[model samples]
Target: MSQTLGPTIAIDLDMLQTARERAETRGESLGKVVLDMVRKSLALRAPVPEYRNGIKRLPWRNFTRKVSIEDVNVLLNEPE
Candidate 1:
């Protein structure tokens, strides 16, 4: 199916430069890189489904995990 193009949007010079760099790194067009980034960001902002594997999961499950200072210190000490 053919998709309709959206209205023109203006971006700052820094944003334009970042998009160009991402395009070069991924060997994709600037438009494709920008669209992919937008899609990813939108997905993050969208609400997640409640049910998974017949279990009711919380929308904030990922963020609700407990993390202690010891865990952070252990991660920091891990050899790369």
Candidate 2:
């Protein structure tokens, strides 16, 4: 049986050259090199957690204090 292949993607000349150099250096095919890079990038990405319900609080959740122009200047260490 014939195997199915992925669709062809168009890349810029510079990017293609870079991938070719990488593939030559690693003694691997350009397709394999690019696939490896894509896999590595995907692996490094943070997985999205499933949210059950309600609002999600971020790291800067407690920084809800109101600030005036003087407060902003003070925070920036700028003179009035």
Candidate 3:
């Protein structure tokens, strides 16, 4: 027994060509490759984290220091 279905999709010509090439290289049908990619894309559990402005204030002076005396002090002071 087998299932049959027909669906219309609009894909860019370049994308289709790339998919065909990948399918040939992997010895799989283009439909299988495309479906696997779709499944993986859908199965991702985490939503992309948005960057808030002014959230990452880096210490430029500490980065430029040849030896980080401040970093050593902070590490020593951190309680278990």
Candidate 4:
């Protein structure tokens, strides 16, 4: 809230679309929606990192479709 940054952060395209929808419905800026998401996410207790063979394996969630630039264009241009 005290600072602003240029468009340098990289986010998953699918998740960005979801945030855009939320911003539209809530009549908030995309950045505000994303900032709230980050706040909620950091408020949660961190997930226990899974490990295998002494190697750290970060967790992942299932995506309905593969994330790609092509997919991003479609999602951005898709009508509600």
Candidate 5:
């Protein structure tokens, strides 16, 4: 398995504990359970907008701050 570094994210501890217990009962890691929940939630909440082959384009393009060499290095070195 590969690993990705993530920043600290604050979540509801009570809800997280409940999900962890449920995941353990199903023989899954908490991360896997959380990812599944996120995928399901996105699917449920965001119906595909009508477009070519249901591909939803982002609203904005090239609107962020300029990317630096460090950003390119990180992208190139990211695990696949």
Candidate 6:
């Protein structure tokens, strides 16, 4: 709520409320919570998911193909 010249961004009400609660619980300012979250997100890499009867693959490029629900089911449910 400052009129000072500074970069500003809008946050959703629900997310803001959650962040505020987190800040209160941690005895830190909301700014600190946001900054920590941003830093952690920037440090994260693509997560590898375990597939049934399949090896994990990554560094996918030009992979524009979309998978349907049936395809997802097939991948999820492997023959016993």
List the candidate 5 regions with Cα displacement exceeding 4 Å.
1-7, 46-80
lDDT of each: 0.86, 0.80, 0.78, 0.92, 0.80, 0.81
RMSD of each: 11.0, 7.4, 10.4, 17.4, 17.8, 12.0
Q: Per-residue lDDT for 1-80 in model 6, tens only?
A: 76444468798898789889999999998888977877888889666675656876555568578779999899789887
RMSD of 1: 11.0
Q: Global CA lDDT of candidate 5, please?
A: 0.80
lDDT of 4 by residue, 10-74 (tens): 99999899999999999998999999999999999887999999999978989788789998999
lDDT of 2 by residue, 10-57 (tens): 988987898899999989989888888778878997555544466554
Clashing pairs in 3: none
Query: Which ten residues in a row are the worst by lDDT in model 1?
Result: 56-65
Identify the runs in model 1 with alpha carbons over 4 angstroms from their true place. 1-6, 46-80
lDDT, model 6, position 61: 62
Candidate 3 local lDDT, 1-80, one digit each (tens)? 77566587887898789889989999998888777877987898665554559474443344554658997999899999
User: Looking at candidate 6, what is the lDDT of residue 25?
Assistant: 100
Extract clashing residue pairs from model 6: none
Worst 10 residues of 5 by lDDT: 45-54
Quote each prediction's TM-score: 0.48, 0.49, 0.47, 0.49, 0.46, 0.48
User: What does the lDDT read for residue 49 in candidate 5?
Assistant: 53
- Candidate 1 lDDT over 1-80, as tens digits, reads 87667779898899899999999998998889888878988888756567989998865656666899999999999999
Runs of candidate 2 with Cα error greater than 4 angstroms are 1-6, 49-53, 59-80
**How much lDDT does candidate 1 score?**
0.86
The lDDT, on a scale of 0 to 1, for candidate 3 is 0.78
TM-score of 2: 0.49
Candidate 4 Cα errors over 4 Å, as ranges: 1-7, 46-80
